[model samples]
Target chain A: MKAQSDNLVEAALETLKASTLRVTEPRRALLRLLAEAEKPLSCEEIRARSEGEFDLVTVYRNMEVFREQNIVQTILLESGKQLFELTVEGDHHHHIICRSCHRTLRLELCFGGELERYASSRGFKQLEHKIEVFGLCETCSED
Target chain B: MKAQSDNLVEAALETLKASTLRVTEPRRALLRLLAEAEKPLSCEEIRARSEGEFDLVTVYRNMEVFREQNIVQTILLESGKQLFELTVEGDHHHHIICRSCHRTLRLELCFGGELERYASSRGFKQLEHKIEVFGLCETCSED
Candidate 1:
């Protein structure tokens, strides 16, 4: 697990360098946290888990940069909240979040290709897509 | 077009009332703006188009109420901005927005059923999904 996370951080660092982004310490710390996250994290969670290595504004700033470079993806939740995670290597997945408790689980499935084709037929090009699902998880559903 | 928009506003007012929400003048005006929108409007757009009938904080407060009552749907854009619209009856659709020009067009397609089923099989229930597609529109594709 540690080796996999290390590779993810390394790959992300290369992405930063190729994009001419400075490899600052806070940025690296942020990357490590994302690569190790089971689910995407809110900015507040990032600040808390980061142990004061950076402030909330710095987290937001670095996240904005990461997002622009496609090194990070934001999952906009059902409650109008947003969370961030790294675009990990070879593990493309979406999430199903419990609206009741905010418990999240990854779904190793995607259907973006079909959507892209549909958009392409309408004269859209170079398409990208984001999808999020929300529901009552098993325990919450029984409530 | 005006008649359809009026109908939307009326339906939204019903939703607000059903949810025990107040039918304030500012809320009414905001509903009118959303009903007449060709596409979702950002909070800034809401403020600009509202013509000072209320303030941004007021706009946000009303939107939060409407959102809770399912009177409004927020389309989370690829740029990580959010736009608001009335959840128009019998006109269910998603958007494919232009990254370069910010042009948005509605697509008469959705596959939420498949996603919901996938989540359901995983013991989730009462599923809700949101999808947003981003690409260069025809005009911007050549740029």
Candidate 2:
């Protein structure tokens, strides 16, 4: 896991270099945090894990830069807080959120094949699609 | 369309009454705006459409309130801006975001199905996922 995380960090650094963003400790720390995090984390969670080395504003600002450069994806949690994750470049996917526990499940499927045709039919010009589903997990339902 | 929008407003009002939220003009207007908007709208867009009736802070606050009550769905736009849309009760869906035109297409497949199983195997317990995808549309690709 540690070696894989190192590779993730290296990829993040390359992304930063390619985007012409300055390589800063906070940015590097964020990359490490996301790479190691078991789930999507908010700015507050990232700051807490950083041990106060960075403030919330820094996280927000750097995240904005990362998003603009397509290095990170900001997902809107049902909690209404923005969660950050490293974008899995070249592979598109969707998510299922546990309605009971707020646990997120990421799935890989380009399900917009039908919607693309639907949009063209309406002349609305379909551009993109994001999909998230909320439901009970097996344990939650069992309980 | 106007009649449909009005019904949405009425339904939203009923939802507010069911929740702990206080129904105010700004709140009402925000719900209406979300109901009628073809795509999720940012705070700035909502404020602009509201015609200066509500401040950005008020819009932010109302957004929090509506989201908490489940009266509206908040969309995480690719631009990192939060957008608002009225949730279609009992219907599960996701979106396709166009990278070129910033247009959003809604899709009906529960793509995150396998992720939950994956999480269960990993013992992540109560795993949930939020997924947003961005790419060029057929129109944008042709352009």
Candidate 3:
């Protein structure tokens, strides 16, 4: 697991360099966390998982920069919380989140092509869409 | 325009009464604003439109109560802002927002039934989904 995590960190570092973002400790830690995470994480979740390494305000600022650089994408949930995940090249997907536990499961679906075409026909350019499904996951339902 | 707005306020009052929420001055005004809005309004927009009749904190608190009572629904934007809209009976829609100007357009298309069925098959109960599209609108693109 540690080796795999290290490999993920290396990939994150390469991404940062490609985007011309500085290699700060907090940025490195956040990128690694997002890269290795099984699901998208909110700012609070990211800070909590950092084990007191980074502050909430710093996480918010870094996330803003990462978003501007396309290093990460934000997933907007129905409950109005924003979650972040690494934006690996050619790895597009949607998310299904458990409302009770906040557990997110990635769905490898890309039905946005039709939606994009529709938006384009309506004179919208550079169209992007986000779809988030909410429900009770297995563990939460069982509980 | 005055007559139309008055009608909308009546509808909002009815909704509030149906949801068992008190028809307070701020609540009534907020609901009326949402009812007459062409697109979702953020808290800042709401406050600005209120013209000092409602304070920022009062708007926030009223929004929370409205949300709990299902009198209003929140639309999450990619910019991490939550916009409020009236939750009228049988009125369902999504949104497409302009990235530059933050203008929002209502989309009557709802393609969530199939996705909801799929999620149910996967053992997810009480499934709900939110879809938001982002792009440059005509004015923004022209600019």
Provide per-model DockQ scores: 0.58, 0.23, 0.60
Predictions in order: lDDT: 0.85, 0.72, 0.81
Over B1-143, each residue of candidate 1 has an lDDT whose tens digit, in order, gives 89988888898888878876779999889999998887789888998998877899998888888887888888877656778888876667888888898888887678788888899999999888877788999999885
Of the pair 1 and 3, which is ahead by DockQ? 3
- Candidate 2 vs candidate 3: the DockQ winner is 3
lDDT of 2 by residue, A2-44 (tens): 9987787888788788866789888888888888888777888
- Arrange candidates by TM-score, descending: 1, 3, 2
Query: Among these predicted structures, which one has the highest TM-score?
Result: 1
What is candidate 3's CA lDDT for residue A29?
A: 86
lDDT of 3 by residue, B37-56 (tens): 87788899999998989799
Off by over 4 Å in 3: A1-12, A23-28, A52-58, A138-143, B1-11
Model 1 chain A: ten consecutive residues of lowest lDDT? A73-82
TM-score of each: 0.84, 0.59, 0.81
Which residue runs does candidate 1 get wrong by more than 4 Å?
A: A22-24, A55-58, A79-81, A141-143, B17-19, B22-24, B140-143
DockQ, cand. 1: 0.58
